[model samples]
Target: MNNPIVLNAFRFVLLLLAQVLIFNGLNFMGTINPMVYVIFLYWYPIKENRAVFLLVAFLLGLLIDIFSDSLALHTLAILTAAFARPFIMRFCFGVNYEFQNFTFKNTTKIQRITYLALLIVLHHTIFFCFEILSFSHILLILKKILSTSLLTIFLCTLFSSLFSPKSE
Candidate 1:
């Protein structure tokens, strides 16, 4: 039960199903859809193989894209987030990120929040930019990104707090 691989696989399936079945149909103010699946990227092991992480990220986004019929938007956004995760972590966690044994559980709350916010904002920005694909609707893109990112951050924080393993 404590195996990281099994836990990750379970998280992947659970988050994927939640996004496709629940979040996909949900709309607030007609456009804000909370993308809670992004949490999987945050929760993935830091020491895991980078290739496998990117592959899983692509597959996750591909699955969401298929369900939402959003072409490749989710795929691109998620892959970008996954690719940029190390840099984000380094920025948030400072020198501690260089250690192979580093984990989010050991980080400060502010660092975790900042890391989550950056990733969510980045993912939403890319997603909305390509989704709208129009300079005329830049306001609309920003609106969607802000609203959706807030909702996602809240939900992700709530979910992570609820499910996160307690420090012994």
Candidate 2:
């Protein structure tokens, strides 16, 4: 069995490349920019140490920010998502979704999709909110939140189903 740590690192690299090389090139209607890469953060073993989780989240978003060259707050968004992950998982998946111990092999597809969808929304909301810190374009921010959330959910569902782990 592949250790979760190794798997996570590999997934992180793959997601970063995918985001920078492929998804970054895709921008539709200035709305449907899907960031399926965040799924790696979503799926990272729940049992990983809290500090490690936050660090990884920061780094993950930092990588995305570097490649996207949008802003520095992207890392903060990712860190927020990671910081809130345990709470969200507990609330949504119950105690069974404990960090460092959870895996796709033990989860239902519906559950995985639902929980991940929430995280994606949370992450994107923070990211876009920071992207538009000024209140001048609140309407545009709202549009970005809605459209990007929809696109991310759809893409993440597809990617998770296709790439979910085969065993616990």
Which number leads on TM-score? 1
Give stretches of model 2 more than 4 Å off.
98-108
lDDT of 2 by residue, 1-168 (tens): 388878888988999999888887788776467888878776787665889888888888888898889877678877887888878778777777655566656766677777888888898888888888879988988889889888889988888778767764
1-168, model 1: which lDDT tens digit per residue? Answer: 588889889999999999999988788778678999999988898888999999999999998899889999999999999999999998999988888677776888998989999999999999999999999999988888889999999999999788887631
Question: Where is model 2 poorest over a 10-residue stretch in terms of lDDT?
Answer: 97-106
* Model 1 vs truth, CA RMSD: 1.3
Candidate 1 CA-lDDT value: 0.91
Global Cα lDDT for candidate 2 = 0.80
lDDT of each: 0.91, 0.80
TM-score of each: 0.95, 0.89
RMSD of each: 1.3, 2.2
Report the number of the highest-lDDT candidate. Answer: 1
